[model samples]
Target: MKPASKSPSLKCLFLVAALAVWPLPAALAQPQGESFSGYLQTVAAKARREGISETAITRTLSGLTPNQRVIELDSAQPGSQGGPPPMAPYIARHVGPSIVSRGRGRHAELSGVIRKVEARYGVPGPVLLAIWGHETNYGSYVGDFDLARSLATLAWEGRRRDLFEGELIALLKMVDRGVPSYKLKGSWAGAFGYPQFLPSVYLRLAVDGDGDGHADIFSSPSDTLASIANYFRDAGWRQGQPWGVRASVPSGFNVGAYSTRLTAPRCERVHERHSRWKSVSEWRALGVAPMAPIGGDVLASLFQPDGPGTPAYLLTGNYRVILQYNCSNYYALSVGLLADEIAR
Candidate 1:
C-alpha cells in the first residue's frame, strides 16, 4: 500500500518514460555483485525454503531481469525522510470538490455493498471509497508493472534489500498457490491491486469480499471495497466513530502547547506535528470545537496543518487507522476529509 501514493508521489508512467530515454542497457548498468540473476537465485532459494515448490520458483523467476526504473524511483523519492510539509495544498488538491464529487457518485453506485463491508469490518463505506479513489482513482488505473518482476528487481537492487526481498518471496508463494504473475500488476515497488496493497499486506489481510472464491482486488469493485474494509479492520479502525472533523480554534490559543512530545517509533516526524490526545471536553475548554458534536469527552488529537491562521482539525484514533494506510499526514487527512464529503 505504500507504493501508490494518494497524491502519486512518484508517477509510474513518468518513471517509465524517464527510463526509456536512458542510453545504457539496464542490466549492464548494474553495480558489482547485484546482478539480476544472482538476486533471483537468492530469492528462489529463500522461497523454496519457505515451502514454495522448486517448480513454482523456477517458473516465476526464470528470465526475470532488473527494472532500472524501480531503483531510480526508489532512490530519488521526494520528501521521503523529510519534515512534515504544509498540508494546505495537499488537502486542497486531494480532498477538493472534484474528488469529493466523484466519490459521492461512486458511493451511490455501491451503497449496498459498502454497507455490508462496513457492518462486518466496522469501517465506513465512505472511508473505503476514499481509499479506493485515492489509491487508483476507484480502480481507473491499478498500475501495470508486474509484481513478481518489480519485487524481484527492487530486492536485487539491494538498497532496501530486506524489505523487497521479503516481498519477492511472498510473491513466489502467491504464484505457487496459483495466483498468475500476469494478474499481479502495480507500482514499481510492488504495491498492487485496487488498494495498492503490497504483497506482504495482501497475503496477510486480503479477503474474499465478494464471496466469489477469490479476493480479486485488481478489477472487482466489491472485492476491492471489501479488501479495503478488511485492511481498516486489521489496522484497528474504530467503528461508528468519525475519522476527524474541521474545527474552530479560539484565537490566542497556544496551539503548540498541545503538540506531541514523544517520538513515534515510525513516521516520527509525521507524528511530531500532531498534538497530544485531549478529550473533546479539554478542547472545548480551550475553545476548540469540531464541526460535529459526538460528545465532549471523546479522545482526540489536534492538527493545525496550515498552522493557527487557518482552520484546524480534531482527529480521532480512527484517523490514525487511515494514517496506517499511507502514514502521510497529507494522505490520511485527505482521505478522512474526503470521506466526510462523500458521506455528506
Candidate 2:
C-alpha cells in the first residue's frame, strides 16, 4: 500500500517506485486520438463492467495519452535497473540523522495525534512517524503527478498492464466516490496522501482520524498518521513489540541450513533473502544474539544483509509486517532503525 512520492518514501515506497513526466509521442500525446484513445476506451469499458459510471469515466479518463516517463521508470525497476547497493550502506543513508531529526520533530508536533492513533490502533507513535518522514518527507513532497494520467500511461504502456489497469479502475472508482480529480495527485505510480496509500489501499483501510467525517489523508496530518497506523495494525504490527534488533552471527555459521524455504507470492525475492522462521531462543542457541531489546520466544528469522562480516539481524514477525508495507529488507530495517532514533 505504498505510493510514489515527490520524494522517496519508505513504506514500500521504494517498493512501488516512481515515473517521469517527459513528453510522449507527438501524435499519440494529449489524451485524444489513436492507440492511446483506443486504450482508454478499452479500459473505460472494463471500468463499466466493474461498475464505474460512464459519466465519471468520460469526465476523468477520456483523451488520455501515455506518459513516456512512467514507462521509463517502470522499466528501470530494481532487478531490471542495476539493482541497489549493499544493505548497510542503503540503511545508513535512509535512516541518517536528518531524517531521524525531522521525524523526532514531527513526532513532537503531532504527539497528541500519535497518542490518539496508538490508543485506537495499538501501533506505536514512533513507527508511524518514521513512515511519515520516509514517505513524502512528513507530507512536505507527495509528488505532483496526476494519478489518473500516471496509472493510465502505465496501463497503456502494457509492461504490467493488469496491475496498472486495476489501479486505474480504482482511481476511477475514487473519482466516482467523490475524491476530487485535483486531490488525486500523488506519486507517478499512483500512491497518494501523506501516508501514500494506493487507491485500493485507500478504499480498504483509510480512516477519519481528524473527526472531520472524511478520511482526507491529503490535507489532514491527523488522518494520515491514523491511516499509517491502521495499515500496520491490519498488516500484523504487534502492539507492544519492537520490529527487530541487530544481532551478531558467528563466523562460518551455516546460513544455508536456516535459509527460508517458504516463498511469499508478493515480494518473493525480498522474502527469499530471509532465513527460515526460528524463535529468538533458537537463534540464541545457534550463536546468534540481539544487540538491543527483544523478547525471547518470539518467532524470528536471520538476515545478514552484508554477508558474514557485516551486521546481522534476528528479524521478528513485526519486521515481516514492515516488509508487508514495502517488502524490502533494507526498507524494513531502515524503518525500524529510524523509529528507534525518533524514540530516542
Candidate 3:
C-alpha cells in the first residue's frame, strides 16, 4: 500500500548517522574566537532559560577571570606537609588560645541568640561557636577571593564541571537576588561568607535571623549563627545531645585492633583517627566512663586522636555531623572540646 513505505525507524537511524558523521559548526564545536562579549551573550541566553536575569548575568560575569590559584588550591591535599606533623602542632596552629578566647567573647555577645539556636537545633552554643571560630575566626578572616569569578572559572575549565557549573548558576541567582558582587568574595576553594559556606550550602541553609531581608553572614552575627544552626539541623543534629564526651579506655584494651580500618565515603582521614564505633552501653561495659556527665541517651564511638594513651573521647552522632562540615578529626574534636571549655 502506497508504494511500500520506507520504514520510519530506518529513516530516523539514517538521519542520526548522517548527523554523527557531519562536522559541527565552528561556533558550536568549541569556545573558539568568541569575544568575551559574545561568550556573555551565549551564557546570558542560557541563564535566561534557567530564569536568571540579564542584569544578574552581566553583574556576575563581567570582568571575570579564571582563578589559577583556586584550581591549584583545590588540587592540594590537607596533610601534604612532607612528614605528618603531630596532632599537637596542627592543633596549636589552628585551635590556639586566640580562637578559644574569641569564641568565648562571641559566645558572650550572642548568648541570647545562641540559647535560641540551641533550643531550636539541639546543637550547643559552644559547639556552634567553635565552628564559627574555626571556619573564619568568628568572621575576622572570611576569605577575599571573588566567589562569582572563581565559580565561573571553575565551571568553564570543566574538570569538575557538574559541581562547579551548578555552583556558578547559584552564584548568578545570588547576584540576581540582590547580593552585591563585592560581598561575593570568599575562600579559594569556593566557600564564602562568615561561616565559610559553599554557594550551594548558602542557598540551602542561610537564614535571615535578624529579620533582615538579606542573609548576610559576613556582617551580621545573628545571620551567621542562624545559618550555622540551620546547617547542623539539616545535617541531622539531634537536639539535647552532646557531640562527644571525654572517656578513659580500659587498661590492656587493644587500641590497634579496634582502630578504624575502613575508609569513610567522605571525611576518610577524619574517621581514621577514631577507633571503631560501639554502643555507649558496650563501651561502659568495657570500663569506659563518661569523663563529663552528659544528659540523654546517645550512641557514641571511641576516639583517641593521638593514639590510645592520649586524651580519649566518646563521640556521638552529632560529632559526625560536625565532620561533614570539615572532615578533620582534629578540627571536629578541637571544636567540640573548645566549645565545652568556653561553656564552662
For each of the candidates, the C-alpha root-mean-square deviation to the true structure, in angstroms, is 8.2, 8.5, 10.3
lDDT of 1 by residue, 138-199 (tens): 88888888787788777767777799889888777677666777797899889988899987
Q: For residues 99-155, write the lDDT of model 2, one tens digit per residue.
A: 989999888898998889999999999999888888888889998888888998887
Candidate 3 on 1-344: residue-level lDDT in tens?
01222223554344433322333234322234433334444555566677776556655665555566766676674644563346766767777777888888888888898888778777788888888888888888988988876776566555676787678777777776777887888887678888898877887889887886989988998888889999999999887778999888877676667787678887665677677877777778878878887643567778766665767788988999998888777778778878887787
The local lDDT score (0 to 100) that residue 18 gets in candidate 2 is 18
Number of backbone collisions per candidate: 2, 6, 1
Q: Give the lDDT ranking, best first.
A: 2, 1, 3
TM-score of candidate 3 against the unseen true structure: 0.81
Best by lDDT: 2
TM-score of each: 0.89, 0.87, 0.81
Best by TM-score: 1
Better candidate number, 1 or 2, judged by TM-score: 1
Which segments of candidate 1 are over 4 A away from where they belong?
Answer: 1-32, 79-83
Candidate 1 lDDT score at position 280: 88
* Candidate 3: regions farther than 4 A off: 1-46, 78-85, 259-263, 295-297
How do the candidates rank by TM-score, highest first? 1, 2, 3
lDDT of 1: 0.79
Ranking 1 against 2 by lDDT, winner: 2
